[model samples]
Target: MIVEGKVVKLGDKIDTDVIIPAKHLKYTDPSYLAQHVLEPLDPEFHKKAAEGVIIVAGRLFGTGSSREQAAIALKAAGVKAIIAESFARIFFRNAINNGLPVLACREVTAYVHDGDEVAVDLRSGEVLVKNRGVSIKCGRLPELILNILLRGGLVEYLKSAVN
Candidate 1:
């Protein structure tokens, strides 16, 4: 999959609570949850995400609780993909399981900036900064993970296979 969108930059060690604060956990609706996503970090994150964006975050993105809601909120809010220096293991898997693509590029934070247009090629693991004319390499998505994302998450992928 190839995803292109404006960047939404965030710092390191952003935990699940910051992604979707605990106060909003009562809601199961993805759209409703999205409205409060990253509220602690940026009050206008929902507005920016609604316009479609690619989140570029520093090391250890998604470092806390393994709530699937974090990924759901982001995907529902129109985050095409996330490029981070590193990711917490559970969050990484949860992202893919929710049909949200995530990439890790150690050099990504050094080159990309907030609001810059970028294109991410999951198959090739290439991130192109459209405004800067720069390319960064990220870890490639394995075929299994790609399959899950292509079918719009694990449940859908399994349903299709069983059908």
Candidate 2:
């Protein structure tokens, strides 16, 4: 499972509300949430990140109320992957549960830049570094979690395991 896209760098300590403001949670449909991803903070984000972008953020990312909608909105908004220094527990689970890859690494912020073209290979556990056409070695996830991602989230993982 390798997700590649243009990097979109966000600052530190961004919670769910900041990712998708709570005021817009009235609708239950994922599309509704997707349309307004970061709409409040940056109205043009959707336009720029139309084809799925790789979001890079600082530590303690996704810190806030446990709203799965936040993860849903990101997926719907076409954010194929997110690389953060760390993730709130619930948010981390929610992301993988929904089939969107959220990776935690100490130096992700250092390796990626806004608009850098990058690919995250969960199977290999490395965020393949691609910048100005240059490739570098960076954060690698655990093989255990990589297997979970390949199965497409925990629910699917469980189903396969049970079967």
Candidate 3:
């Protein structure tokens, strides 16, 4: 699978609370959660994210809280993928479970600037920063996880499997 989008750059240790504030946790609906997604970190994120953006962040992105809603909110808000130097374990799993592709590329954060176009190839684990003409290597997702994302998350993947 391949995903392409404009980049939304972020810094280190962006925790779950910053991804979706605790106060907004009352809403379970994906669209509702999306409205408040990253509101604390970037007030204009929702507007910019609505057009399908890819997040590029520094190390330990998604460092606090294990709430799956954080991933759901990002996906609903139109975040195509996230390329970070590193990720908190739970957040990485939650993101994949929700069909939000997250890649860890040690050098991606340095070359990716906000609004730059990026294309990620899941099969090859290559992240291309279009404007800069740069390509960074990332770990490829295992086939099972890739299939889950291709089906739009675990639930959808299971549904197809049962058929």
Candidate 4:
């Protein structure tokens, strides 16, 4: 999917707690998770962060947590992809497993900023920086992850695996 939005910039080491506060975990449904996504960062985050907007963050984004709900929260909140300098392995895997597109870029955070409308090419792993005359390069996704994403997520892939 091609996403264009004003970035809601975040710093390094954004963890699951920041994505979805622990207080809301009582419910199993991911719908609640979306409500609390990034609530800690901005009480009105849900209202301000438009759906299909891209979340741009520094290193270690999605660190310090392994819960799948974290990815679900972002997805449900309409976050299309997370562009970060680095990400926690578990969270990265969780994102793709849940059909959430994530890309790793070391220099993206430096060139990107809040409220900057950028275009994300998920298939190409490139970000066309609007008016900056620059493009952020995100390395290619693994074949395994691509296959899962192409199938609409890991579960769907598994269902078709035996065919």
Candidate that scores best on TM-score: 1
Point out where model 4 deviates above 4 Å: none
lDDT of 2 by residue, 45-103 (tens): 77666787989899888899788888888888888988898899889888878878888
User: How does candidate 2 score on lDDT?
Assistant: 0.81
lDDT of 3: 0.90
**Candidate 1's error at 152, in angstroms?**
1.0
Poorest 10 consecutive residues of model 2 by lDDT? 132-141
| Residue-wise C-alpha lDDT for candidate 3, range 1-163, written one tens digit per residue | 8999999898999999999999988777999999889988787788889999999999998989989999999999999999999999999888998889999888887778889999999888999989989888899888887878777788887787798
Q: List the residue pairs that clash in candidate 3.
A: none
Candidate 1, 71-117: lDDT as tens digits: 99999989999999999999999999999999989999999999899
For model 1, give the RMSD to the true fold: 1.2
Cα lDDT tens digits for candidate 4, 25-136: 7765866787788888886777665456788899898987677888888888888778999999999988988888888999988899887788888788889878575788
Lowest summed lDDT window (length 10), candidate 3: 149-158
**How many clashing pairs per prediction, in order?**
0, 0, 0, 0
User: What lDDT score is found at residue 57 in candidate 2?
Assistant: 92
TM-score of each: 0.95, 0.85, 0.93, 0.91
TM-score of 4: 0.91
Report the alpha-carbon TM-score of model 3 versus the true structure: 0.93
C-alpha RMSD for every candidate: 1.2, 2.3, 1.5, 1.7
